[model samples]
Target chain A: MSCNLTEKVSLLVDGELSPVETRAIERHLLTCIECQQARADFLNLRQQISAYTPALNTQVQQRALASVLAKQGRAATRASAQAATPEAGRRPARIFGVPAMPFAIGMLITAAVALIVTSFVFYIVFQQAERDRQQATNTQANSSREQTATVNQPPNTNNDNSKANTFGASDEAANGKQSVDQSQQQRARGPVNSESENRQTFAANARRVRSKRPASSGTALARNAGINAPLDLHVPELLPPHEASAPRYITINATAPVAAPVRPVDAGTLAARHVEQAGLLLRAFRNARTVEQDAAADLSYEKRRARQLLYQNIVLRREAANEGNVQLASLLDSLEPILIDIANLPDQPHADDVRAIRERIGRKNLVALLEVNSTALARAYE
Target chain B: MASEDAEFTMLFQEFYPSLCRFLECLLGGRASVAQDLAQESFLQLHRTVWGTIPVGEARFWLYRVARNLALNEFRRGETRHRLFDRVVEALRPRTQTPEEEYETQERQELVLSMLKGLPEDQRTALLLREQEQLSYREIAEVLDVSESKVKTDIFRARTALRERWAQRVRAIGASVR
Candidate 1:
């Protein structure tokens, strides 16, 4: 067992084993000479270690004691500090620290709340701005429409004005109160037969005055011969014989009251005057279109075309801007159905020829328009 | 100082030295670094009790903490401390003859150096048994090993130590003769 058994003996000296195991190991070592020697050497080392009793300095021990007492006191203080913490499901109280965990959490919560509040405010403002843009677009459209209507139409009658007033009030009530009503009403009158007949009468009176010219050198030749006499004239077809004949009766009847009768003009003079008079009637008839035609040409070609395109552009842009605004889109949608109705209507007289033709005439008048200009067609009967 | 820190300082002063001495033995006489490691162990204890670390399972927590710190020190390699101890031994009061002291010091160093060669589990078991005086159950708690395994590791460690010592003794004797 010599020095070989020293490590085992040290473990034995430490009393690491149960009494039974210790006894068994001890019994084996007693008879063995080398083991006995190793046991003595281990005993010598143990004795030396045990003999060196270095005392712990008193101050060091006291310091350690004080540290332990201080730790206990701090632990008690910590316990109280912990008791102040709010439990689960509780709102935290303000506490002091440089970026304390609880304070950081509270700040994070407050930041999140503030962000949500700001976002909500922005959303409301965005909605309001969209509404304002839509309202402005509607106002511009309405003004342009009124301008177009006034330029194209005659003075409105009492009945038409009353009807427009009633319609405006009713339309306002049906929709959310209108900022402006952009639609215009154009009155439609029947064929205009009476007006054309009045113009015919006026043209006849003009012919009568032109035939009454005192210089009748051509008139005297025309009165001397029968209807078979050949007289070259600019307008022989228009002067029914009676219009030229009436002036002779007037000259004969005036002879009783007159001291000296005015001398008659020559045949050439009579012929030229009648031709000039006929040309005047034709010019009047050709130029006699109602004010509405002038206005329709002005508005439809210049103002309405530009204005309509602008309105269309506004509607398209607004539709894009109102992508998610249901109210705005619906408002635009309600107005879209009426655009064709408004556009196809006439500028005056309450009749919408384009609309009536589109509905009733269809292709019936398409081929007819090739030969008939609108102004010519309107003036044809007159 | 804050009231809490002042209290903590008093507690630190009380526990530090003994804990250091205990760690010195646990880490196989790594005495020079023992104080810092022991202080670190107490800081963990303070943190745990104060709810900086969650509290619960706190009693005997310091012993476990000190043991872990010692093991961590071993793992970290105490080369500077070992060199420092060698220097201190040259200056400090010593009761043993220079020859005996040298031999004893060499043997202790030999044991510490050899500890690296052993399986980590076996070395840990031996240290807990010899230095910490931990019961089998307590050792089991710290190592998270079965009690029987702890016993076996200690036995294996002792056998390895004995074989190593015998070989060293034989080599020394042969060289001397």
Candidate 2:
């Protein structure tokens, strides 16, 4: 027969019972042969199971431990490397040998600079536009003043108008000479008849001439015309009618063409225009040598133009230097020697002399330089 | 950290052998698989919960993890066919005399067959109690079952194995006759 205490034999062998419970189980086991046999079987089973598998050999244990440690070391190294460089597995893209971050920063800086330059250009353009608008207003006002002066003139001055209009259409240099003679004659006659009106007309004419040229040159031109004489005022009543009419006619006609409004040219625009013209002249001069046998006759016009350009170049170079335009000033300085060489050429320049100038032009690469600066300055100021 | 590693190493050295023996019986006498699962259990403990386990619970924890691994291997069914090969490998003679080695192998085969005959849970509980010498409560902890269940399982496993042992002995006597 099976004993109920038989199951407790398993727990008892495992020491799961308390001391009192162990005592009771032991007391029961003493008399119950079946319980006693169950306990023996459980104890025997433990011994059998324990001996079923052998312990790993010493060498195997050490090797297993070493493998574990080695693996752990490698894992630790990999983890630390990952921590040190987070992007170790995959690096970021680059542009033109520059890394992404710095390239992006450079692009941002360039965009900002371009934005500032664009705004500055807009500001200059607006200022130039405003100046043009104001100049138009002043031109209209000056034209009204001239019409008023013409309408308020004496009856004898009508005949003088016809004479003045004729003079206005004549050669500018001859008109300037006739003005000088008329001013001297008026000074000899002394002041008479509406001196204020004559003085007003004379002052207006002087201002008109001054507006068309540079300050120094305009002043010298005014002196050459004798319009600078303060006492040479027209006095119609103090003179013969013909003599009185002559001063007003000469003054009005001599200054008429000069009175039309001329747009003020800044040094930059002037230099750009000069470079453009010089580039054309030099290119044509170079092409003419190849295209024509009588290049000397064809070059006469260029030589005369070169002399005029040379004078303008000296003045412009000084202005550019004073304006602190080193690039333009340097270009003009290089151009000056070439202009002098062309201007000093004989009426029929020798083939050797022409070749020397052409060689110098090519050696300096002045044509390309001039073309680039010309377009650059025109784009900058336009 | 060094002290922690030292402690883990000490734990590994102390328990690795017993754990392997426990898993050997659990996995039907597969010694190599038992050693692998045992080492894997220790590695898992180190990786996941080394410093976090309570002091005495690491042994229970290791057995639990190893038991789970062995369970997974059982589910794969790959080990079933390899069971005979592994039994043969385990019984392979080494340093013992031929007569002693034969007797040892015979006894080991008998014990392994009886142990394998028990249900999986009962076998695991019984092995944890008998082989590891764990208390019923410790077996409960390792198997994550109630202590009463552990007690019942071990008792049932013992009764079953005793019956099988008696039958085998009687059969041997009959064959001798």
lDDT of each: 0.41, 0.64
Model 2 agreement with the true structure over A1-382: per-residue lDDT tens digits: 3688887776788777889999999999889999988888778777887777553554455466667666665655554455457584486434245334432343467567867997997688667766665544444433332321111233443322222211121224433344434544443332212446445534344334323422221111122222322222222232244754444322221222222222334556777778876775676556443213565655775687688789999998987887677988999999899999988888767788888999999998998788778767766767
Q: How many clashes (backbone N, Cα, C below 3 Å) per candidate? A: 28, 1
For candidate 1, what is the DockQ?
A: 0.01
Query: DockQ values for all predictions?
Result: 0.01, 0.13
Best by TM-score: 2
- Evaluated against the true structure, the overall lDDT of model 2 is 0.64
Worst 10 residues of 2 chain A by lDDT: A215-224
Clashing residue pairs found in predicted model 2 = A192-A235
Q: What is the C-alpha RMSD of each candidate to the true structure, in Å?
A: 47.2, 42.0
| Residues B1-177, model 2: lDDT tens digits | 554565576566557777877887887777777777787888777755666664356767889999999999998875545665556365443658989878887888788789889899999998887776666766787888998898888888889988888899899999999
lDDT per residue for candidate 1 within A1-382, as digits (tens), equals: 3345444554575565678867876986877676665556544433322222111333433354456556655654554454456652263332232222342344467577867987997687666655554444433333322211100111232211111111111111211121111112111111112334323323232223223322111211111101222211122112244443222110100011111111112222222222222222222212222244443532242223323533653454364344443432433343333334434445552324433323432233321231222223223322
Candidate 1 wrong stretches, greater than 4 Å: A1-382, B1-22, B25-29, B46-60, B74-104, B114-116, B132-134
